[model samples]
Target: MVSSVLQWSIFMSIFSSICCLRRDYFITAEEHWWDYAPSKQNLITNDRTISDRLIQTTEYRIGSVYKKVKLKQFTDGSFRREIKPAPWMGYVGPTIKGETGDVLYVHFRNLASRPYGLHPHGVQYFKDSEGSLYMDGTSGRDKLDDTVPPGYTYTYRWSMLNTFAPTKDDENCVPVGYHPHVRSTKDIDTGVVGILLICKPGTLNPDNSRKDVDREFVLYADTVNETNSWLIDQSLNLCLNPQRCRQLFNQKNEAFITDTLMYSINGYIYGNLPDFPVYEGEKVAFYAMGLNLGLHVFGVQGQSFTFKRKRTHAVVFGIAWFQGLYMTTRNPGRWMIFCKVNYHFNRELYYRLSGMNTHCYSYCYNN
Candidate 1:
């Protein structure tokens, strides 16, 4: 029998190289100070009264602190150990997991001050790990990952091929995003970005998690545009009248760029995102990305989800794209997830989806 079919193809190629794996992360590209209202109070108007229009600081509204440049993660590669995410993951990044035949190895490093790198989108890499730049001609070390200045270091190396798996009708896990393509919209408006996922075969857990999900969130949605921040001139010196924020930023006016553009998520706003526990029946998921800078509609207020296969209650995307919503929590209590448009639902995000509602709310609750 052809020697037992070549010994069962060498025992399924040594059991697919002992159940594939690689994973390493250790990212970086720092720079601090964020605070999109760290309870500088206003849980839907519990109010701290600076005439709370969602934490107003006036003079030209630089209100919610700034000066970003994120993409941190590090727990190794001696980038000192830091893994603290969850203040509703604002300033994004961190969450680069894998599984589809696994293999990642990021290891970036650029301690921020300018130049950046680390691309990612799905998987499989080439062109020296394409970290985005134009002229793909291939010179020197294949263009040192496009641009990784400031106290440098770079690695990239992705792999997850099986055509990047997941599609028996999808959903065994599958996200996609990563940023700082050097000048990619000023390095994602100076906040870098992240979220990768992957998964499938046997559906993870050797600590890759998701043995069928039990709470996971990522909700991106952007439009942060803090005037193309690179610390927009040191955040116009934390404005309170940095010459009327350089005269309404040289009159970019549209009501002062609609009170300093920030209709966010994973970057907080209004409700100041921070409160996530979710109990009742569990299962949960919620990946839902964006950044093509247009529509949003993502929703939730008590429950009803499944998206893409449709059981919907809201899932309209845009902001580059990527979606995966799923729910199982059978109504808990303090809900609210948000972005149903209507001016994104409230603190005036450029008002008028028939009179704004600006909701950046986030609250899952259990305690």
Candidate 2:
């Protein structure tokens, strides 16, 4: 049955891999030209996979650009605008010049201040003797006026998408639950850059029930100046709701248990669900938001307008059906449990549990 499932899966021409790990599955392949373009159709309907194609494409070439800069305040108190040389920005294509495609344009900006309304835009694309990767395409600032608000910093970046698709299996996406993985700088530069505004938790996208509730912690990612360019690293964790993470798994992993936690949040021993533990004896609403800029051309932010964080109000909802379980000890570690649950409001609730541990541990379970 597993073989049949694998056979029926979309075939990754650009990215291909053969599992080599015994306990955990690993797909490795030589990078190819087409691996950069991952399409929604292919991922949703085709026989091809993403990782296989990206790895295969990288064999021919690997390209990336980076820029680091400091911000300046406006004397007039309006906003600042000056495109100076970034720390570094360029393309990593084939060694041969003629072998490369047009230099993919990467633009940067900062707009994470007040909630201004803007549209979604495009992604950057580069083609060379080897192939291409689609990246950095965004819309104008969420709102396009220079009304700098207090505690707002923005960063904008751009890149290219050589192929038609938008995702590849080989791509190392920001892992959920880790903030830096999705926002901070790292060895590899992913197509995401923008300003980070230090605002009240509920200011950007707040929940009325939780608004003014300073006891909980909220973590989210947004593009600042340019539509997209994010600095991230492996050590930096990706924050994801336990329920949504479980949904990524099979049904066997979706069951719920009250005695144990389903997933970890902020590296804490808890489940990734609605109203999970934010700290000891303190549980707050947990959510996972999938932000997208929609289809773009040539990877630019002119048309950008859309951003979402799943189904919760304000497009942010809690992970309910899919869940995870984790336990910690004096020696912090993680464990996964395949469990199921009955859900209400299509959101995952919280449960507490105890486990066999020589050290003190906290747990979160859901149903």
Compare the candidates by TM-score and give the number of the best one: 1
Q: lDDT of each structure?
A: 0.72, 0.20
TM-score of 2: 0.20
TM-score of every model versus the real structure: 0.37, 0.20
For model 1, how many clashes? 11
Model 2, residue 265: distance off in Å is 12
lDDT (0-100) at residue 42 of candidate 2? 20
The weakest ten consecutive residues by lDDT in model 1 span 348-357
After superposition, candidate 1 runs with Cα above 4 Å error: 1-41, 50-54, 64-97, 103-116, 119-127, 130-139, 148-157, 160-189, 198-201, 204-211, 219-242, 246-265, 270-279, 285-331, 335-367
Evaluate residue 38 in candidate 2 and report its C-alpha lDDT on the 0 to 100 scale: 22
lDDT of 1 by residue, 245-283 (tens): 777787786766666677777777766676655566777
Q: What lDDT does model 2 reach?
A: 0.20
**Model 2 CA deviation exceeding 4 Å by range:** 1-278, 293-367
Best by lDDT: 1
